[model samples]
Target: MTNYDEVPYPDFIHPATHPGNMAAIARLHGVNAPPPESCRVLELACGPGGNLISLATLLPSSHFEGVDFAAGHVKTGNAMIGKLGLTNIQLHHAKIEDWVTHPESEQDRFDYIIAHGVYSWVPEEVRQSILAICQMRLSANGIALISYNTYPGWHQRQMARDMMRYHADGIEDPHKRLRHGKALLSSVAQNVPQGSAYRVALEEELKALDQANEAYISHEQFEDTNRPCYFHEFAAEAGAQCLQVIAEADWGDSTYEQVRPDVASALASLPKIRRGQTLDFFRRRTFRQTLVCHESVAVSEQLQSADMASMHFVTSSSLQGDQITGSNGLSGTVEDPTTRQAMECLVAEYPASMSYQELCEVVETEEPRSLATLQTDLFNLVCVGLVSVSASPTEVRREVSSHPRALPLAREQVLRGDTVTNLRHQPIRLDDTTAHLIRCCDGETDHAGLVERMVAYSMANGGLVEGDQVVTGEESLRVLVTAKMTSNLQRLAAMALLVG
Candidate 1:
């Protein structure tokens, strides 16, 4: 076993691990899932509790627990929890084999169990143990999210991994090993011809590796116990433990819209699980975040718009004129006037979600549309990644406090650095101005006090300067500061960072 004491995985949020998403997907598939707001979540091999802690901060009513073999991770994560004053989550230092033997582990049942980045990195025995834990410890309607490196696509990456591992063999230091590994790839990439298949693949892999964090490379590729399996193989393993495949965490990947019509037609006739396996081959999917439930739970393969009635819909994508085009260009154009109007209404109440019925009522007066058409449009939006559906509605605090408050976790993170997890469990990158604005929202200052503090801070920090001249006049500075503060506060609220 590789001890993560020396090189720990980065503390980060994985959207797939969010209970709200898992529960929503389960419900979409016809499973009666637990409510995310009050669920009990257990994560195996949760490094430093980064993902779980973020969830704990956002959903204060929910309970979270994490178990990892790394004592260093446990200690550091516990300290962070203490600093944040979160009593709903905890971290434990214990190996899977040992942890499974505990009385509490046997007695307690979790509504959501997450094993991200663990299954493919461990031995078969450990993998089986994880599945057994999920089968034994999961609540009746609970879902377990397991992320792993999948096959067909991983075959290409493995060729590169083999070369890197061989080149770095006997190198004691991780940093030195990483340097040598990159050098080897660079040499090969430069020596190969420009258009050969091998050269193209090698260069593409090298570019990806260069962009990834050193810690990720050290543990993910160079780790000794990496075992990539086919989708059927993984499903078989889960089946043996009495868990059935529900659906994938990323809903978009499950569709065949990206493939040729002929290929998709052939795949459509296959069985549900077999269709997934075939799609993986055609898509060359290298990784997956799979969600599974107990064997007894019947999962619906077809998605019905009626299923979305109980769910809440949210989208950060902006509407331009009467079209709701995605920023990523993946979601094909939606130009229906009624659909555009609905999107505009949703964006106005940004971060918060309106139920399907509520949305219909709101837009019916402007352009009356059939319920089926509305549901179909919403589903299309979800497929394109322009919209997100959740089991729990957004918890918006509309009444700003005497001292307008932001999320404590986000506030602390902004003070320390420019990246912070928003209340929606998504990371928001901050510029200097935005970072300062977030740090100022401590719930201890009124609007005037905040404006005064921001003015002084901006002047001292060069934020108030336009080109070379500082806006120093009292009236000018106040107007500038107030406008900037209001804009940022609205943005923060839209991002779901503000709290009452």
Candidate 2:
């Protein structure tokens, strides 16, 4: 599974990456933390410290040291670090094996060690060396984060890879191999070998290739792009090196409820902490690369469980929404109303497992909310680890629970329902009377009928309010007779309600 990491000889884009609240992720996994100032960090294959620089900037009190096999990456990261005026960050240019194999090397222990792209891309021996570095260097209270490719997902990609590799095999030059892969994928079938699984993939890949720009093709077909791994196989490989699965990077999509497709159900009993369906657990349509923590922790001292200890684990992001829905049904902060609606859908779906790509699909192909809105909702979910996250193949650690009771929004009366589910998981917004009125809003109820109900109720009370005593207006909610008659027809239509 450690097939693709640690292989970038001298190529990497140097975009500044954002950092999640690692202190919080550790708390969810039952790990403790000292203050940022007291923490020591290490990042294996720190790509220009894009994310690490962000992390350092956010947690200035923390100390960081990074190693990348690519010397140029190290040089670039150092340049950024210098520009950022980072006092506590350091970098090294050397392979994991070279560093660990040094006999008299200083034992480099860390509080929180993260390696994103190196583990899966590197060769097996190098991967083992990286794990050894963790085992030998990770402090007691320290946690090591390693990311790699996963199964089930990789299984499908293997189909595409098989076709690519098959076409690639006949060519000796790397670019030629790439051309073959691109050609077969884009070419129309000329008596395609009957029922070849690779045939369809080749066509699809070809179409995608022709449409894609040159930059993408060149990067994807790099000489080192041939490495990959499976999910369970990755876990086993990590186990061999004494690493444990902490959680997936992106969370909230799969909680325990959704992922009920026949295939997911069959894997249901596999001792999953929580389960759900996912396409890309994080980012876009890319396959997963799991993050792992060392089984043996560093930092022997007991940690202080301040506000951070109780803080929910979520990806660090600036999403836009007025309110976000927690997996537990609690509403979180958002920038707008639309964001709120999107949160409701994520909550309603409540799958045990969801890939980042799958959630995007839900947002795009379904009701198609704004990308910013969906991201904000996901960010809130990530903060709490309710939707744990990983850009690579990852696992869900938190349990998924159903919303208490989804009550429909109506007008004039309140109706309690058991449970309603859908991908368009919007919230039950309207209040009791309003909700009931909405349900009955067929443009049929007359003001007379409204008055009759009021009068009948008044008669039962032995008295009735006169027209003078009652005020009615659009803004005044009491004008239920008219307001409930036609408030959210358009919105309901958008929700695809069958009501007339």
TM-score of each: 0.91, 0.51
Model 2, residue 242: distance off in Å is 3.0
Give the best candidate by TM-score.
1
Q: Give model 2's clash tally.
A: 80
The reply for model 1, stretches above 4 Å from the true place, is 101-107, 333-338, 364-369, 397-402, 415-417, 447-483
lDDT tens digits, residues 1-500, model 2? 12123332322222111223344445545556434445677878775554565456545676888877666667767876776577878888776776664224333567667776566566778888888877677665556666655555455555555666777775655557677776655553444774586566565556666775443454344445435655555667677877765555443322333444774556554443223223333212334434356666432122222322133222212234454444465445655455445444545433323444555454444444565555555554554544444222211212211211111212211233311111122223343333433444434544445434433433444342336564333233234333542333333333322222
Q: What is the TM-score (0 to 1) of candidate 2? A: 0.51
Clashing residue pairs, backbone N/CA/C < 3 A, model 1: none
Give per-residue CA lDDT, model 1, range 157-183, as digits (tens).
Answer: 999999999999999899999899889
Error of 1 at 427 (Å): 1.7
Best by lDDT: 1
TM-score of 1: 0.91
